[model samples]
Target chain A: MAEPNRSKDRLALSALGLFAERGFVGTSIRDIAKATGLSISNIYHHFGNKEGLLLAILKTASERLLHELQEASNQPGTPIERFKRLVQTHLQLSRGLRKEAKIFFLDEEHLSPEGYRANLKYQREILDLYREHLLALQEAGEVNFKSPTIAAFNILGVVNWHLRWYRPEGQMSFEETSREVTEFILHGISRVREP
Target chain B: MAEPNRSKDRLALSALGLFAERGFVGTSIRDIAKATGLSISNIYHHFGNKEGLLLAILKTASERLLHELQEASNQPGTPIERFKRLVQTHLQLSRGLRKEAKIFFLDEEHLSPEGYRANLKYQREILDLYREHLLALQEAGEVNFKSPTIAAFNILGVVNWHLRWYRPEGQMSFEETSREVTEFILHGISRVREP
Candidate 1:
């Protein structure tokens, strides 16, 4: 027999793929059930509702990211090293979780307010941790920017836009893109005054 | 009475605002007529059909963007200066034609294939312009990236996503965000290699 949890995992993954393409309002439990070859009853057994399933997916990814961040923050050589590791880990995690990221971005708004707020709390915590790291780098004279918040948004916009259009089949490996971004960011913010 | 053509222009602008928020499918000719106080017949006379009005809006914005790009490119300056000018012009243009930009980003697929192709052709031309500009900058040592295609997308993503979340009423002006982005892009690519 198929592993009991394996069927549920496959069902959840299929649901995520549909959610990414059709959007939350445009999808239904019947759609998920049809895609996964499971009865609607089985889908309901796995998830209380579409909202509960979306909540489960989002919370799972958030925990993965948060655990990675907490680990990276604890084990690091330098501020720059830590920042670069954060970028690297983020890129790899994003690549592996590309489908989930799409749903996380476009469908999170569909979650009920209480569920939405709960997910956002974890997301904001992630941003805050990165902001603190960048602040430390700024304090150390390693980088320069006028406003850390705007700068943080710029950094994130540059990185996170990858989810919208990045293709794994592209000419470069995920490593190359990560390296390029980190190099550009570190070099871009180098603190030397004009000669 | 206001000049009838002046009224026609106002009618088109109001249609753009409603379409941006409600999406093309969610909006209807009746809604546009109600919003503009023009009978559906009057709007039909001016724009031919609901789809016709959408295309007219698309054409107006695309032509304006193309004209601005040509003007920016014609400016006599270094490639970097030309690029910086392009960024400024684009920011200004997006701010002025925000509703149109929103429609293009959010619902271009709703346009007829012929209309969508027309819209995309202009977009491709503008994207190629940016690609060419960056290639020339790489040659001139003003900018360098491992992947110019990805870098261009990253830069444009930062600029365009502003429409979704930027506060026109906030402390930052359109020009200020434009300048900040220009600085960020240049600095993100500064030539000095510092670890």
Candidate 2:
């Protein structure tokens, strides 16, 4: 049982790397087998097919994100603080799961019909978690945004776009980058004075 | 001249639609020819190859965006207002050129080595424009953000992410949506009291 599970993990990790580099459509099952030193039959036995591997990677990615978000939401804080925490949490996860996050954004459309629907369900849940925090902030008279839905997306856009530019080995550390993002989302670029 | 230009336009438009739908790698010259009612040889005559078609589409998209952004930056306004105009202009263009924007984000990697560098140069110019406005605002003491580079990217992320969700027949009009986005970037979700 342990040996088979190890093979499955190897296939998933190899597939994730390939999918990130070559994209899902461009990466073939044989490529995954080659990367993992596993036979084609073994890959099939583990993942059923390439689409199955994609779904598994996506499911793992979404589940991890959802878990982190849920924990953030449950943290004790004011609505605004909690919202900031949620944004920070998202940034941290994106940085850590950079490959998975890239696949989430780029290759989601390649999922089979049923897999696409399942993935959408996970995505909507993530969005709703953000929306819920914004709704709470609005109720507390802390935020003045027009639509919670739009506001949620705007915040997500700011965080998710970091994937394109943020480099760990680059000048700015993740700490600095995430802080700047959180502050920008909360107060924007305009100078605000405390009452 | 007229006949040749029309053929080029038709080929470009058809290629844009196909690339957006099937992706750059998934799309072939035969597909473009079929969509435009032109032979494969005709496509080759106009584009030289599929990569050439992609480069043309990207060039047109980037040029139009730069033109609008340039106009916005030169407009008579305070730095903040000009920045808002830039954001609004970006939103409008993204909405108008939805397919092109999709291709820009998803298919850019498929460009040839030279073409990739050219596209990157265009992208950098656009980013620099945003940074310039933010620098002006920062110098004027109208805003206080850590890094103009990160802030510029944040603003772009908010605008570009809209392409993923914004719909014409949806509840929010482009005007309302763009306005909300601009306001969000300028002031964020926090309630700001007038000084």
Candidate 3:
């Protein structure tokens, strides 16, 4: 990456860390500059203000997640398979973008009004990705439910919360944890004796 | 309630609103006192400090939730019914205590260490309530999943995230939304044709 791109990346990453640790309001521009070794002017030049840095983090995180979810949803397979792939992709992204994802979940209140509106658009798109596939699966007689949107919300809920407790050094690897969580969700825990 | 009790309730409620809106670090004791119209000494006399107020809010919220979960779990019914009731109680609580629940979900990072540990004990009891019921239901062949603890977490994720987007004036009432969300979890969106 070019120097500017690298500096921007460093600045964004530092902002994510500070926002996660100290909160968006609690964290200051000087804190970000100090963390990244970038002057306050350079930081402001790249992003207009603290809110701008936050917007940048939200945009980058959501865009990357949206792209991955789209790809996973487009994969050729059963509806259940597509759902599983979406969950797996979500788990991987949550791991890779740990700080950014945490900030996204906790810092939405800090987004300016216009940024929040735009961010909601991205959020709806990601949700629609889940809802559309769920609708298809329901129509095809694969998964059974009354509301596709609620189902999508439930599905997203299961994976979005992984950022809180999912650990890299935990006993269960991400793959195993994802598989177990996905299975538990789809089939539930009741033992159904083979008919 | 006694005069002191009423004043404490007002102070704690005001603290919850401020904590949810401005965050723990952002909202000061002066702000809390101003919001409650309580003098700083009165506030301090009731709760030693800001952390005391926070701990009180957390303790009250968790106790109420834990009590409800215990009641719902102990209700005489099948495993599925108990699970549904748990979901219903969770929905109602989430609605009734919106600010406190939001703070519970988002402001844990600001809790003092002792508060966090006590809060974790309450959380564990709530989770154990879900897990034990799921285990019973699994043994009864009512629901089928691999891990009880993971299954509980999945169920929780579905309801907990409602703090983010659940709207009171939206198309669905809390009753209707809770029913749909609960149904989606139990049956999923996959349409399974009856054999």
Candidate 4:
């Protein structure tokens, strides 16, 4: 049981790297098998097909995000504090799961209609978590913004877009970058008295 | 001359739609020609090859963005005003060139090394434009933030990200949505007096 689980992990990790570098259509099952030193049959047995592998990767990443966000939302804090925790947790998870996050954004279109819808559902749930927090902040008179839906998407854009440009070796460490992002977001949405 | 230019525009437009819908590797020269009613050799004649077609599309989009951003930067205003114009221009152009923008983000990895570097330069220029405005704002003590580089990226992320979720028939008109985004960004970066 342990051996099979390890092999499955290896296969998924290798496939994630290839898909990130090449793309869903460009990376074939043979490519995954070659990268992982596993048999094509084994790849099939594990993921069923290329799309299946993509779904598995996306599902794991999405579920992890949803879980973390749920925990963040449940924590006791002011609306501002909870929102800060939510942003920090999101940035940390996104950095930790960088490649998976990239595929979640870029390769999602390749999923079959059913797979696409399922992935989108996860996305919507993740988004709703953000929206819920923003709504709370609005009710608390802590944040000012139009359209919770648009505000939620804007916050996500700021956090998720880092996947394209953030590098660990760059000047700012992950912790520093996370703090900067949180500051920008907090100030961006906080209520301002008329000048 | 006019006939040839029209044909080229058609070819590029057809390829742009196909590339956005299908991954670049998944899209063939034959597919573009079929969609455009042009011969395969004709596509080659106009753009040299598929990579050439991709380069042309990216070049157009990048140049247009650069031109608009430059114009916005040069307009008469404070750093904050210039930044507002810049953001509005970006959202308008992105919404106008939705498919091309999508390809510019997603299919850029497929370019040759030279093409990739060329595209990166344009992107850097765009970033520099954003950075310059933020730096000016920082100098004037109008905005509070760390690392103009990350600030610029966050702004772009917020603006560019509307490509994914914004819909024409949705609740907000393009003008209304643009206003909401610009307002969010303005508040996000503005300096707050300590309580």
TM-score of 2: 0.94
Off by over 4 Å in 3: A188-195, B188-195
For residues B106-180, could you state the per-residue lDDT of candidate 2 as single tens digits? 866556789889888888999999999888888887464768999988988998998888888898888888887
lDDT by residue (tens digit), candidate 1, B51-162: 8888888888888888987797769998888888887777678888788887776566556788779878877777777788788888887455766776676667666766
Poorly placed runs, candidate 4 (over 4 Å): none
Of candidate 2 chain A, the 10-residue stretch with the lowest lDDT total is A186-195
TM-score result, candidate 3: 0.90
Model 4 pairs whose backbones collide: A188-B188
Q: For candidate 4, write residues A1-115 as lDDT tens digits.
A: 6465887888899999998887787788899889989888877788887788889888888888899778976899877888888988888888888888777788766778998
lDDT for each residue of candidate 3 in B1-195, tens digit (9 for 90 to 100): 446488888888888989888678778888988998987786788889878888888888889888877887688987778777887788778778788777777777767788778877877887888888778877876454566776777777877877567888788677777877776556421223234
Q: State TM-scores per candidate.
A: 0.80, 0.94, 0.90, 0.96
Residue B21 error, candidate 3, Å: 2.9
> Which one wins by DockQ: 3 or 4?
4
- Pick out the ten consecutive residues of candidate 1 chain A with the lowest summed lDDT: A186-195
Query: What tier of docking accuracy does candidate 2 attain?
Result: medium
Judging by lDDT against the true structure, name the best candidate: 4
**Model 1 residue A8 lDDT score:** 76
The DockQ-derived docking category for candidate 3 is acceptable
